[model samples]
Target: MQEYQLALKDKRIAWGMAIAIEPLIGKYSGDSIRPGENAALDWNLPAGVYRAKEVVMELDKLLEAMLVQLGEPVNGDPAVLLDSLQANLAISGQHASLPLGPLALKDKAGAELTSQAVRIGEQLVIWAREINAEKRALTTYGAETLGALEFRSHCYGHPLIPEATRLVWGPLGGPRIMQLYNEYLHQFVLLRDALLPFANWEEVPFEIKEHTEFKGLRFLEPAREIFLTQLLGKKLTHKAIVQYAQSVVNSGLTKTGYGFQYRLGTVLPAGLGESAGTAARYLLKWHPVQTVQTEETRDLAAISFDYEYDDYYAAPRNEAGKGTTVNEDTLPVSREHYDGPSIARLLPNADSDRTTLRFSLEMEGREFTVDLGQLFRGHRFLYRPHGNDNAGDALTKRTSISSHRAIDILSHAGLVTNPDEIHFIPTNGNELVQWALLGKLYPENVVLLDKGDKEELEAAYVSGKGFGTQFLVL
Candidate 1:
């Protein structure tokens, strides 16, 4: 883990986003059906559990519709949404022991969606639809409805900012660099948000026209002088200035032809059904699994844990952090932020350098930043993994992620520890005891399970061939 973290900090390695998909098997079937749909059931009983492919498809469609409503182009890869979705399942032996839905609060439609599964004879099934207090089928935010709501206005596309604009500003008492929707220009807003006290960025409306028109027109005079002086310093003529601006607008940024593509009226993560504090959404899709009517088999329920890690996106603290509320923000954490160093005793090297560290991450398909030193020291991240795809020609892919990238990502994120410490040999069940003995000599040494090692251990415990996956075949 230390080595990987060092690599990330040194820019020797980097990773993209990752996701986990798991099939959920519900316990409700027969007359035990509930009035609302939750993670527990799909409302389509007797068939047992829901299919992962179908659940992903449903979610994809839902997100597409929502984006279209937000005025995003519906065509092209929907990677923006798919890249951030993760698979989650709730499992427990007793029907009532596991956390079930309505995992979230009631939506504005005044309907309660539940997570109830039942057993009919030898089969377990789930409820897929939503039911209201009157037991009437009503439209609500569920697997079926995409949780769609018109909370605010949104638009995608950049405003046309002319190159001739110029103005003056304060603070430095000199001209600053200028651009037509340039990244450098946007830094001022970010700087203000970070340093300005009592910054209510959420209440600050985003207007592409205002951005393009240079709302505070007076500030640009100094910026224009600086831009012209640089051009003249290079012995360039007026023609050069126009050409430079045009070239930048053409290719310096997104293919949308703007260095900073303006996506005004942006919706926060919570507006999209993400639980407060998490950039990703938590959903349980029920799938049917066949079970024999044996004493042990009858009472046993399967459980598994998976996680997706790559980077963390740092949006406004009020939008997706510890203090965000479910009413306004979806990414809320249950505890305070803690991403600093862990106890020296818990690490392999207590004397490792701490001055050089990097904690860049992505959240909800957006760039996010957080204090790693403040996070890992106090918080443990829990995530869901994308189930291995088993389709023809794609079966060779063991996980949804590229194996090498997954290793790199997990290590840098501090979710996996000491990749070299993983052993393929069978355990004698004394690893924990051995760790205590070893700790006597190496106080900083601690046993950490890398992803591969954890998978092997799980497979051994479940007597499975691969990553001990649990999915319904029906």
Candidate 2:
């Protein structure tokens, strides 16, 4: 690599190997272009153009082979033509990235344990990309370095040779394939570390800090972020934020909490400075823990559960609940889908506390749990409606919020979106006449009484009592 860099300039080069890849018509450099700039740059050809004649000759023959494949004559601007061909080859034969499996948590001995009672760091695997080009593919250049160029381009995330130059020079050489792969792997690892994603709560990890996955929470949208900022623009609370989250169904709670200033009593910024109130990336987790303490609470044979696929018939040899049924079809379709996983909220002998909500799914002979609160903690911010706050009677825009229920009130009262911000608040049973001045329902009360989504309510009620798991509708 070092030797070729010294003499790469001033060589009239034909760059590229395939037919469709348009050749870079001008000189090239390590200088990456700006966001909107054109690809062409005014490059001064480098000095050493002589010592590479032999490899360049071999490139001429390779060009002939590529031309034959394209059914085109090998007679034009060699550098440009060859480069165009290589680009086309790349487009047609692009390599694919491999799929990453669910992140795992395992003991030093590699045993998977329940999240409620375990410890371990999350594990990640890195894979390398393929780089298999041909020597016979090089054509008409003074230096045949197609392979070397391929490896170098990927390593730098920038192309080494201009498509035009490669036609005349590619077959000469490129960076070591092994070395390039290693560098790519190292950089990707660093990039992943920097991203620091909020956990996917849906997976129901077997461990706490290690394999936590959020089930119902999805990425908080920018629009919702703005709405939340408007709602609690004065000061934010993690609690009110969680309440607001119930409406979105699959979404997160803002990680923001009240921040205090000497002048102000207890306050939090919309999102400190440039962040717009949504950017304090943190370490968060969610996982499930199962207990086998009592007789009735344990898995049972007498009360066999029904699902789309597979059935249970047997019980443990002793008193403990046990079964040997296997079915892949019953897996949770969406981590947030409030259907079967209700086991955490249903089974008579399930959860220990009212605060716990469980998302369940069975995969590969193992049961998984996704907790709502755990998922909320993983994200940086929560969604809040902008317009409403406080108990109200009049149709004031700023004090009232926008919600599935409140939408009717705001629309009928002619005060929707009139305020700079709005927020959604879950409805609690309350009489509007007593809470209002006009002797009618208050605007906030309108939403509180807007019982439109009955199915969702029914599902939540079932999940909450049936399996000791509750779904906060958001």
Best-fitting candidate, scored by TM-score: 2
lDDT of 2 by residue, 1-474 (tens): 011010112211111111211121112232111121143111111211111111122223333333333223433324444333233222122221111112132321111111211111122210110011233333322232322222221222322235433433445322333233223233322222211221322221111011112110112233344433533243333433322322122222223221111110111212111121123323222112121123554321111111111111221111111112212132111222222111122112223322222223332344443322222232222221222232132222322223223112212321122222222323231211101111111112112112324443332222211221111213
Question: Residue 305's C-alpha lDDT in candidate 1?
Answer: 12
> Over all chains combined, what TM-score does candidate 2 have?
0.20
Candidate-wise lDDT, in order: 0.21, 0.23
What is the Å distance of residue 93 in model 1 from its true position? 45
TM-score of each prediction: 0.16, 0.20
- The true-structure Cα RMSD of candidate 1 reads 28.0
lDDT of 1 by residue, 287-391 (tens): 112111123543212121111111223211111111111221211112223232211111111122111122343322433232322222211122122222332
Which ranges in model 2 have alpha carbons more than 4 Å from their true place? 1-99, 102-175, 196-452, 464-474
